[model samples]
Target chain A: MNPMIAAFLVLAGLTCASALAMAWTKNLLHAALAMFLCMLGLAGLYVMAYADVMAVAHLLIYVGGVLILILFGIMLTQNSRADQYETHNDLWTKQSGRFWALSISLSVFLGILFILNRSMSSFGMVSNEIQRSTKLTHVGLALLTEYSFAFELAGVFLLIALVGATYIAKHHE
Target chain B: MNDIPLSYFLIVSALLFSIGLSIMLLKRNMIFVLMGIELMLNAANLNLIAFSRQDDQIQGLVFSVFVLVIGVCEMSVALAIILQIYRHFKNIDLGAEKSRF
Candidate 1:
């Protein structure tokens, strides 16, 4: 196999393994750390796909910002007990019924694969021509010109949601 | 078979999406559920970036950027809400009998 394909497989494996670890672990902190690894792998995959801008943005947003947010959330919400080892609830159900979730997800994946296989014939196979060197200017222009309204709407929505969330979260004594 | 085919990306994305869904359904912790949601969002974003590789307009890439922003916003607000819930109920697990309406 080519080096690029090999790299892709390695990244894919890391992402999937971390995700499964996140699912399997009962410890919340361990799951969060696994998610961090998973996100890092995803950013590497984005870089491989020639979306360096997105990879950088994703790393910044998820690793730098959101992960910190999640950590703080965990800290603030957790019970203040230095001695309690069982912070996480025992949430495992019976083993026999657990397979249903995996089976359902597998069937959904197979369905998607079937659809993609049918549609693959129609899409022309285009070579991966290297695109522009930088996306910052193009993204800025598109945000201002073609997507200005939606951009503004997102800002407004975020503002409203922030205000609402703050209001709801405050102690109402 | 050859270079990384579009199908490879699609299948990986599909698996990610399914895993995310199963996590959402199976996990009892609210924070874990939120992580699942984030995973699902990223899976969709990956699909968009992969497809936008073929299009000259790069619309899918642009859309994915917006999706990223929205996901962050969602995460912040949801975590804040979870904190409040924990303060009131002393727990963050879903379907607790004490918190039932």
Candidate 2:
């Protein structure tokens, strides 16, 4: 087996296993830990896909930014008992009926598989040549040139979202 | 370097999306549901990156970047809303009882 395929398999396994762990756990903190591992594995998969920029950005945004936000959300929302000290956090979370969730997801997966199989032949390769060159420069240039307007819009949108989020989270009393 | 088929990526993403769907459906906690939404978004992003490999213009990559931005925006706003809901109800469970109040 080629090393590249081997690496891809390993990364995909890590990603999927951690994702499953996240789904299986009832503890919220355990789920958060699983999500961290899942995100790390996904970043590795992005690297294997030659998306180094995306890998780094994903690590930074999901790991650094989003995960922290989630952790904070968990902390701020919890109720404290009289006997509890700061050493521990109540992390157990409730879950609904597993039957419906499992059946729906399984059916969705099967449907997607059927569609992919039927349409496999229609997706002809656009180019046989693979560009192994680093996409950083190309992505930057394109974002500045062809996609400049959208790029600026995303930036402005991000600012608005952050400000709005802060406003929404404030004490309204 | 491109030995991997696009189908493999699609299959992985499909699996991810399914797991995410299940998470969203199964978890009663609001934060857990948000995590599921993030997983679904990431699965879609993975598909975009994989398909971008075949395109000379790499349009899919650029689109995925915007998707990432929008996803972050969604996360922040959703979490904030969840925070307010928790304050109002004193619980974040999706199916909390109104009789308790």
Candidate 3:
């Protein structure tokens, strides 16, 4: 096998394994850690796909920003008992049935696999062209020119969301 | 090294999506469910990037960037809502029996 394929396999393994760990673990903290690993693997995958800008942005946004936010959320929301100094929420609960969930997900995966297998042969074959090195420039131009309205709308939406989130999270009288 | 096939990416994405779905269903914690939603979104993003590799326009890559922004916005808003829920109920677990009549 070629090195690219090998690297892809490794990254894919890391992503899948960490995701499974996130599902398997009962401790909320462990799941968060597993999500960190999963996000790391996703960044690596982005690099493999030649989306260096995305990889870097993803790392910054997810690792630097969202993970910290999640940690803060965990800290703030954890169930604490007044009588005991220790603080840990009972994060796990017994579900009535695990088999149904697993089976449903497995079938969905298999269905997607089948569709992908059928569509793979139809993709036009072409030599891999040299990827444009000017990704950031091109993306910026496209966002401003072709998708200008969407870009402005996203900014507005983000501003609104931030305001609303802060209002909702504030201590209510 | 040979180029990675589209199928490889698709398969991986499918697996990730399925895992995310199962996690969303099985986990009791609201935060865990949110994380699962993130995973599912990322899986879709992976598919977009994979397809964009074959296209000259790079539309998928651009779309995925927007998707990323939306995902972050969703996360922040959802977590804030969860915090409010915790403040009100003193717990963040979903489907708890106390609220239901």
Candidate 4:
């Protein structure tokens, strides 16, 4: 058992477990906490894949930016109609049912696994070029040179989205 | 030069995507649904990064970066829309009550 595989197993376990916890819990806050753990585990998995840049960026964006946005959405939207307790804020949510959701997800996962198994040999095209160099250098240069247009487009799109979000969220009375 | 089999990553990615799909299907809260969508997006990005591991060009890595940016954009916009929906119906549950969406 190589240490790398061991670490990957641990991180994948953490990611999947927290994701399941998020799916199982009805409380909004608990789900948010579970999402936090899931994202952290995902960042770990990215690092294991030698995507240090993507891992750090993912950690920053999901943990710092998106999570805060989600928390704000939680706070701003609680109706307070079912005020079970003062401190709790009535964060419990509802689900349609367990049977369909569970069955559908299981089926989808198994189907994907079967397909991946069938197509396994096709992915071997990259087997011979297993470069272990840090991807940060290549990613940076490519984003600036070959992908400069797309890179700028992403920035502009982000600006537009933020502006549009603020406008949409404003009090429109 | 650690050589972790790619199948492990794919399996993990599949599991994450399935759990996220279940969450999206099961949860009624708009925020919970959004989180589920985020999870699915991350799972796809994981596949991209994993596939790019052995490639020298790192095309998947760059694509994943753009995906991350787009995911953030979607999150912000969706959260804002959810906020407005909350104001309209005074609740965020998609199917919890008489509301349908």
Docking class of 2: medium
Candidate 3 lDDT score at position B71: 92
* TM-score of every candidate relative to the true structure: 0.88, 0.96, 0.93, 0.96
Q: Give the TM-score of chain A in candidate 4.
A: 0.94
Q: C-alpha displacement of B20 in model 4, angstroms?
A: 0.7
> Which is the better candidate, 1 or 3, if ranked by lDDT?
3
Interface RMSD of each: 2.9, 1.0, 1.8, 0.9
lDDT of 2 by residue, A84-172 (tens): 77576448898999999999999999999999999998777454566666799989999999999999999999999999999999989
Give DockQ for candidates 1 onward, in order. 0.52, 0.79, 0.67, 0.87
Name the DockQ score for candidate 4: 0.87
Give the per-residue lDDT of model 3 (tens digit) for B26-65.
8777888899999999999998887787667778888998
Supply candidate 2's per-residue lDDT for B38: 98
Model 3 regions more than 4 Å off:
A87-96, A125-134
Q: Write the per-residue lDDT of candidate 3 for residues A1-173, one digit (tens) a residue.
A: 78888999999999999999998888888888999999999999988887887889899999998888898998898777675665554455434258887899989999998887887767656425737464778778888999899889888888888898898888999
Residue B24 lDDT in candidate 4: 92
Ten residues in sequence with the least summed lDDT for candidate 2 chain A: A124-133
> Interface RMSD value for candidate 3, one decimal?
1.8
Candidate that beats the other on TM-score, 3 or 4, i.e. the better one: 4
Q: Point to the candidate with the largest DockQ.
A: 4
Error of 1 at B84 (Å): 1.7
B1-95 in candidate 4: lDDT tens per residue? 46788999999999999999999999888899899999999999999999898877889999999999999999999999988888888877886
Candidate structures ordered by TM-score, highest first: 2, 4, 3, 1
**Selected candidate, larger DockQ, 2 vs 3:** 2
